[model samples]
Target: MAQEPLLRCSGMDKSFAGVPALRDVHMSVAAGEVRALIGQNGAGKSTLIKVLTGVYRRDAGQVEFAGNPVDFTSTQDAQRNGLATIYQEVNLVPYRSVAENICIGRARRRFGLIDWKAVNAEARERLAALDVHVDVTRPLVEYPIATQQMTAIARALSFDAKLVIMDEPTSSLAEREVATLLDVIRRLRDEGVAIVFVSHRLDELYAVCDTITVLRDGRTVADSPISELSRYDLVSTMLGRELTESERRGQHVGATATAAAPTVLEARDLRRAPVLNGSSVTLRRGEVVGLAGLLGSGRSETARALFGADPVTDGEIHRDGEPVRFASPQEAIRARIGFNSEDRKGEGIIPDLSVRENITLALLPRLLRRGIVDRGRQQEIVDRFIRRLDIKLAGPDQKISELSGGNQQKVLLARWLCTDPEVLILDEPTRGIDVGAKQEIQNLVRELADDGLSVLLISSELEELITDCDRVVVLRDGATVAELEGEDISEKSMLHAMAEGTAATGSRQPSGSREEDEVHD
Candidate 1:
């Protein structure tokens, strides 16, 4: 006998503020199948998932879960109906114990009271299956971010779920932990649990997914078996670009410099207590250096420490071959250093301000005349950057919040570039933007490097770093784990060194050039 599909959705239509996010989308998954929902940022994957999960009431669609029609008005209702979702940011209580988080509201009962021992035992048993055997009674916040996410995964899967939706599940997990996660996903698939996996990592999707669904510009473009599509085809479909393999490889058509290039900035033994420990890096003039690591791996911390946005308890920093120590961002700026934070909404944008205002926000001091502001110079700077970066907007006076995510990021980049910085530290510059925007940013970064600007690039997508960077410094648990350059910067070798809890260790050599050092973490 044929088994009914665990979940199905047909003609799903969703919109926000009159903008169509999902257009007549149809998707389905049978029991025991792993389906991948993939697309560039802003491609409506999250919107469709939300519609299916009842996080948003669908404008038009038919959704069936576990052989029953459902219009889930709430996530709780969806969970009760055997549909569970695990988001990238864990939705667990930080102060609660891991066991409590996993078994809460579904606790074992005895004589009208919760069975504490049974609850802990069940939670432990489930987490143990995923190879995470932490102290179940300890507060969830006590563990690292990766461990907490694993706990959240265990809790979601333990909800008697017939259909599970994992949104960027491995974003916070290290490569080794990512391997364990794939094993758990395979076990669930074999056990007939329908899984909807959403991730940007193409390598991972090809490895674990049975079916592929590609979305572009808020429309369903392709839906087929994973075997029917190549990695190139999938990316091309998502991007609508017929880029050659070399172009896709990001071989960097930007600046070229020999080993004769000078060192613009260097950090050695960087220590910011619990977050950054003994991390070292060198930024050569006219080069892009990628900082590679999983979540909580000190990638962002290293950027912040180098930029003096965070306190550096111990480290020797040199700028232009001269010893220096930055007390704050002001000092870093004085030294011609720029930083673009990952949290764009909070740290980068001033929502109510116009595009022109946001771009010139950092240049206020330079644009002053006799203790008063100079709007003319500010507007001139804004016009140059907007035109140069090809920022799409109605006008410079338009509210920054009204622009797309990509444009907002460009505004932030312009803000730093206006300072004429010698070195730029970008943390997740391409994150949450569409592929077109991502490509533009990459090209711009390379162009700047070619013009003798040094860049410290951080991105979760290994391909982005591999394509754009001259050297990559791998971090693990708040320390430098490996340094790869030239032929050593392949995805396979990176995943090996980024493997969690391994003896991976390496450092940048004295010449500040990539070729000299080799280590395995």
Candidate 2:
């Protein structure tokens, strides 16, 4: 009596090398369903998506699509069979025109020649459907990241796919762009397109997804209609524990006491041409200061400038009230400053290296004597931080790529901690990790600040800034607009400043807490 689902996977099992990435996983999506696939990093969400999309072969599983069992050998084969995927990273060629990137494989042909006019027109129309307008002839690298993301979405939908799998689609999108994408998703579902939406943004999941499937440690832990699951329960299920009242509020433990702490690093009037206009931030010893902003508001740019990864065109950086210029990351490191980048897969981890090597990467210079690494000292530091961070890996000798996303992140953290830096800059440190890993990183940051390490934290999550920051600096259009501390730092205040580019200096009580009002009155 019930309609058969459009896409279904049962008893799916996959392994890499000797480690199992998925086990006994089951999922189903109706013809017009928007299903959410969520889990902590390395919980097998990516693995299952890869298995379904033909990126990786499943050892054991039955994948049924449109009333037939299918095993695709490659992504192209899967795409041709009416299943399309937009990966977490945009897979389009950056150097090619936007039209070429969108219509590369399936370009319209006429008289044995590719139809350039038809291809460009189709790409333009597809992007326009998503409310994105751009020159299709221009190279994709010429567009902003948000535009590129929309282009990817347009390409996936252009396939007339029965089931479209989107992984972290809004990770680089601005709030307005995210709303547009969600609307497009709703339209797709209404038109009978099944969508498997993968994102860490809970609000987006609730907004667009019809069903929810949760994975944990390579197993299907929970599956239900989206309405039947509450946010708390969703997180609890993914984390494998019920969150406490404090944890629910994202309150990090060991809030630093740094009222009298001296400033360790300061950037004044930092200017970088395209992305960063003018931004500034100050980090004090024993303090965790958050740089809050929307995408493209210069949050990462500011962090990178401070780390000397991207040299600022005009700015002054100071250490201990003395002016300093770091032309490179090596110079910054030598000055006891460490940086963890947001692009974990691309910039943060060296996948080919072993966990031990990646962990000791930054500190290797100090561990070397006469151009030879002091293996004993390197191992001592690596072992200490691995245990301290609770990194989950087979052994230190294992390739870093073999570890889960969270463990890889911990190794990156260990890499910087081993440097014994006085100041650390973390950009979106918990971006794609699960709630449990997020909390652990937050706790570690708080503890580090408590132990007198100054941290400049950049995160798009307002709750993260409110929970862990001693001071919150809001950026708008690549410039600092507000700074809140003490009882003034709240979600409402930060959102106000981030949107309006004005200081939210406690004009009114934050809706997040009545305790502040009670205490104030």
Candidate 3:
């Protein structure tokens, strides 16, 4: 007799504000199997997860658990039914001890008094079963993000959950931490637990997932065993493209720099406690330097330090052979340094502002005369970038939130470009955007570099970074591990750096090795 699926969904449909977020989506998970749910941003992956977890109700669909039809009215209802979800950002009380975090609402008690000793002991046992060692008595925030993630997993497993849904679990983990997580996941699968893993890291997906379910524009495009799909094919399916070898190779015509360009910006021993540790790199005129690493590898931290978005506790930044200090983003801007943050919605864009207002935001002072707005000058700059970047919107007057993700990103780029910056620090520039838009942005980046603008590009897409960057700097645990230039930049090399935490031959020497690296907790 064939065993039934642990969880299954059919004809699932969901919408928000009349916008179809998901349609006719189907997914199934079997006991002891690891399934990966993957898609580009806004492809309805999150929506499907929310629907499955009862965070959002489905307009139409059938959910079955162990051959029994079920409808969960709330997340608690789903939890009660043996389904558990761990978000990308672990949600737990920071002040609470790890034991309390793991068994908060369901703590064991005697005479209605919570048993703290018993709770910690049980929590310790659960973590031990997962091959994780941690001090359960300490506050959850006392551990590194990776350890906290493991604690969350321990909590879910302790609940006797038959199925676990992890969304971007490794997004904030280091290389060693990611390995620990992969091991924990495998152990869970061996114990007959079903897992749904969601992540943007293709390497991580291929490493741990047994099967893959691809969603595109809110629809299930394909579902199959991992061995049945190639990386190129999977990407094409997710992107809805008939990409050629050249396209897959990312060979777009754009700016290519030579080795002799003068270095415009340099960082020596850049440090931010608990995130970046003595990370340093340099950007030259007409060059695109890429920061490559897994999540929590300090890629964003380095960018922040360089752009003065975060305070640099240690290290020195020199521009044009002169020491420069940027106390804030405003000071950085005054020095012709521009930064496009990774969190576009939260940090990059102002939703209520018009396109024109956002684009000319950084250049307002230059466009102002005697404290009055120079409307004509602002319009001219906005119009130029809008056309040049091919930003699609009603007009410069359109609200930024009304535009698509790609267009919103373009507006952000325009925002920085209007500053006429000598150095541009772009973090995850193409994230949450469409394929065509991503390519366009890449081409624009190349074009700008060709026009003598120095750029520091940070992206999680290894292939994109390898192809577009003139040189690639790989970071591990907040420090530069390798610098690949010319022929050294390849997907294989980058993967090796991320996996083995080793510097490549001829690559720039990292400050230290994995063993010498300090653990945050």
TM values, all candidates: 0.66, 0.63, 0.71
- Per-residue lDDT, model 2, residue 143, is 95
Name the 10 consecutive residues with the lowest summed lDDT in model 1.
Answer: 512-521
> Which candidate do you rate higher for TM-score, 1 or 2?
1
Question: What is the lDDT of every predicted structure here?
Answer: 0.82, 0.82, 0.84
lDDT of 3 by residue, 187-213 (tens): 889889999999866667778999999
The alpha-carbon RMSD values of the candidates against the true structure, listed in the order shown, are 7.5, 8.3, 6.3
Residues 53-144, model 1: lDDT tens digits: 88899999799877888899988888888889999889999999999999888889999999989999999999997788888999999998
Question: Which candidate number maximizes lDDT?
Answer: 3
TM-score of structure candidate 1: 0.66
Between candidates 2 and 3, the TM-score winner: 3
Give stretches of model 2 more than 4 Å off: 133-135, 244-335, 339-421, 424-521
Model 3 pairs whose backbones collide: none
Candidate 1 lDDT (Cα, whole model)? 0.82
Instruction: Judge candidate 2 at residue 135 and give its lDDT.
Output: 95
Off by over 4 Å in 1: 1-4, 110-112, 129-131, 244-331, 340-344, 352-420, 424-521
